[model samples]
Target: MSHLHIPDGVLPVWLWVAGWVATLAAVTVAGRVAERVDVRRRVPLLAVVSALMLVAMSSEIVPIAYHINLTVVGGVLLGPALSIIASFIVEVVLALLGHGGITVLGLNTLIIAGEMVLGWALFRGLVNLAGRSRVRLIAFVATVVTLAVTTTALVGIVAIGGSGATARESGALDPATLRFDNPFSRGVFSLGLFSGGEDHGHAEREQHTVEAVEDEQGPDETGLSVGRFAAVIYTLGPIGWAIEALLTAWLLGYVAQVRPGLIWGGHWQRSGGRMPGDEGTVN
Candidate 1:
């Protein structure tokens, strides 16, 4: 829900550069933490979770301009360290596939990875507080809270990027009407093989591309202030968050029932105090 799909050149140079530096440092730390675990076993799980995140993020909910991010699910299964690595992998792939600009890959990775790490901690804490029998409920609550925090972070990043970072797309949502103005918009779901490729709303993007080429100075302020942008995001964010939370809760609950060790025991468990009934660290 918090994936920033802002195009290249939108973010200021220093901000994105800092994002890259921070992301590299995070990956390094995650790698060091992963060294204690059996990489051979964890690698496969990492691949699967990363693939799931990539798929979920590739498609957009046309109405809300939102996509489901399964970072919470990844966090629970892979734990924080592996989840960070997986997030970096997914964001890089997403950038290549045109889900977002390559320049913002590092920032996207950090935001999504933060969601994963925070969700992991929150899920563990809630389970400890409320008891493991309510795993699904714990997952739901954790996912909702994680998405809320990360979504706010997303808004903050855009704000920090200043007015130039505002997206200048045509599908402007009328805050008063609570409706989109783009006539080509279809139903809620829109899937594209490559997000930047020809699909639903391709014409609008093509027009924007031409306009961008004409405007040598880059994007002119679309009059979409940070406050209004934040309003639109907050307006639509909860719907996407709740949808994702339900999906994650069901998924984690299923995994917990079949493979309890995946949730309760892993590298994250080794780094912290173990939970009751945990069968030592595995993978």
Candidate 2:
């Protein structure tokens, strides 16, 4: 769900190129670290996580219009660096299948990577600082981090598409226009589409495109106020994050209790820092 599937011609060439470069650098660093950590042993598990992400994000849920990618869970299990690399690979393959635009791959990867890194960091910190017993806490934090990362990415999309500045100016012109009056509101509403009935709604949607173009052409071409944009992003981002956190925490807690060894990096047949079956070998 964390993965972004934005189409092409939305972001400027420079932004796309920059995103690609950043993703490449991040992956290269991750690869080196993976090698040092003997990540080959974990490749099979990571691959499975990657496959799951792809499948999970393939179907969209109605109303929300958002697809789910459990890359946060993957990051929790595989660590941030590996998670980033795994997601990048998965996205690359999905692009081939026409899941997302080829040009937006870099931006997509960056967005997903943000989720993985933030979730992994939050999960690890909570697990260590609060200790394992507080599984719920860790889950909550993870969920928040994931959502925040996602919202930030969404804002980036708006900024790239020139909607952010437009919204701000629209708000300045008419504060009512800034607020999300409808659940389906895609930023500013154009005046031309204020007619009655379903045709009106369709026209309103069409007007959004025209307004966006006009917004980009003016002196305040960016279409967003930086401060307001950031505020809106964080405000909206937390909602999804909280939900994910609750789900993740509950799932992880259950797994931890039933299969503690799976989470603590301990052997299944072991207790008190010793493997029960390896006693004879040690002797």
Taking all chains together, each candidate's TM-score versus the true structure is: 0.74, 0.67
Candidate 1's C-alpha runs over 4 A off are: 164-224, 268-283
The Cα local distance difference test for each model comes to 0.79, 0.66
Estimate, for each residue in 1-283, the C-alpha lDDT of model 2 and write its tens digit: 4655557755566777887898899899988876665454557766887998888778765445555667666677667677779878988988899988788788788888888778778877777798888977777777776676577666766566645434343334332122333557553433432322222224465467456656767656444465675685465445545556666777678767876655555222324433212233443
lDDT of 1: 0.79
Candidate number of the best TM-score: 1
Per-residue alpha-carbon lDDT of candidate 1 for residues 207-283, written as tens digits (9 for 90 to 100): 56456544744455453378987898899999999999999999889888887776767644574433323465452
Model 2 alpha-carbon drift over 4 Å, by segment? 160-239, 266-283
lDDT of 2 at 121: 80
- Supply candidate 2's per-residue lDDT for 107: 78
Candidate 2: lDDT over CA atoms?
0.66
